[model samples]
Target: MRRHVAEFPDARVVLNMRSGSWALKLPFLQEVVGHSLRSIYLVRDPRAWIYLMLYNSKPSLYSLKNIPQHLSLIFKDDAVREGCPSVAPEFKTIQSVLSRSEANPALVLAHLWLAHTAAVLRVNEGLPEESYLQVRFEDVVNFPQETAETIHTFLGVPLSPAALNQLLFTTSTNLYNLMYEGDISPTNINMWRQNMPRKDIRLIEDVCGGVMKRLGYTRLAS
Candidate 1:
């Protein structure tokens, strides 16, 4: 922090932690960064999270003790260094359910997702709603303009129409555009319905029902 202050004295540092809810784990972060610090918390559809975990488990899993190292690798320019973050991935509870012998990976991932999300929700209860903003990935991709305006407004940043258009164009571009392209597509919003098996989807809905409800996500009819 001291070095950051020395180097970019006039700049405000925006720290992003997508894997774990650092606010819940490190209460002091709020104090150290000061009360003026505003947060943007991104929540993905639980099914999407499950699909990601099925393919990439280890990196997506979080551990409080290794977060600093994880963040260092995450911020590295090298493609090989990037990885998803998780909190307490090695805890006995997670290990028991995600063991190698576990035949149902989706179910395991769903449980893990639920556990982590529940922790975040519980910890956030004490925080003032104005201190942070929660945005759904679905909304950001489908309604880029509105989402951008909301985010900028929440952070008290002035964004002109030109800037917003550039942002949208940049984000809506296809991923193949090497220079910079946005993979913002509505197709991914419910891609899980086609990809995940019915039983697995049911498992996620059953286990994560409460959190899903709080986040305003409708579940499959039972």
Candidate 2:
């Protein structure tokens, strides 16, 4: 931090946070990126995040909390739509691929996503709006240009129109879906719902019922 401050005295650093920070009490942030911090928090729906983590479980920060433990704030209706939105891919083709979870993945994923989201809201609480910024991960996936533009404005950086165009049509992230079978997971950009067993879906619904309905994730149309 001392060197960074000395090198770029007026440089305002923006931390691009996704998940794990809020869920794990942010000890990781304090250790790695806390000093000399101007923060922009990008949050995702814990439920949608569940889908991502289930397939892309990065040990770096993903923690699975199967059961809900009491926290400071009990979530109510109209949860704040932080800057980043979490995406739940309801695309029909993708669902048919990730249908197999060795264990009860639906409920597990739901719990993890919701619990973590709650944690982030708590961590971001009381943080001055300027010092901390919140965004939804989903908004980034579906509307990259708009999302990127928002990010650009937030950080006061120049985002070229060409760069935004490239992000919009990219198929790289589709690899996450089993849309291409030989692949481990479907890549139709999310079909977790279509492929998951009915029971598992029900389980997820039970655990994350409120969020699902509120966020319109209960059912998908082809």
Candidate 3:
């Protein structure tokens, strides 16, 4: 969007970014962006964020092209698809990991999304008041029109009626599960309790728990 906006002489920045982008704090972002830009800092429950990441990790659900070229090993697993024509020969690596991991893919995703973004939050603890006003995805999903109204008002931009309608109708579907009809009941929320490798989950917790709890993760009772 920034690049698209840049083409016009009167173009202004309309940043649709995460609350934890930490751009304002980093000199690189601010130095490059300067006063010529404005942004909409969208945020969501770290849990939901992580869960979506895990769900998107499945080869069936995502395009490998979306994966950062630099994070090749990370997404190169069988989970990453070569493309629509067909998967490449080397796709088995991700396939095996998907098959071998004991963790429920959805739960693993929730935990990672939560842990990673919570860590990002902790990393940028004291940003200036005007830098970003965080908005939760949960709240927006529940009251989308109100959120849109708030955003339009804040940025002084007109969010078209069509845009508002699109927001209201977007359906939530689980990417990993077979295509079917059902609510994304959080019944699987803690499936990690049984299936995830103890060491990895422990590493996740130790690395992100302090901030995770601050953002409302339920810690296992000691």
Pick by TM-score: which candidate is best? 1
Best-to-worst ranking by TM-score: 1, 2, 3
Off by over 4 Å in 3: 1-27, 49-115, 122-127, 171-209, 216-222
- Per-residue lDDT of 19 in model 2: 40
Predicted candidate 3 versus true structure: per-residue lDDT over 1-222, tens digit per residue: 446545664765444556533433333344445444444445544433433343324542323333323223444443544552233333323344344446444433443354345534653455444444556555565667888888776666799999887766652332223232123323343344555456545555654566567654555543
lDDT of 1 by residue, 60-79 (tens): 43332343243344234433
Top lDDT: which candidate number? 1
Error of 1 at 51 (Å): 2.0
What tens digits encode model 2's per-residue C-alpha lDDT throughout 1-222?
Answer: 546756776765454546424433343444444443446666544434455545444441124533222111132222435853232222121223224343344554565555555455555465545445556655666667777898877666799878786666452444333321222222433545554455655555666666455444554332
- What's the residue-level lDDT of 61 in candidate 3? 31
Question: How well does candidate 1 match the true structure in TM-score terms?
Answer: 0.69
Clash number for each model: 6, 24, 7
Q: Could you tell me which 10 consecutive residues in candidate 1 have the lowest summed lDDT?
A: 175-184
Error of model 1, residue 211, in angstroms: 0.4
Q: Rate the local accuracy (lDDT) of all candidates.
A: 0.64, 0.48, 0.47
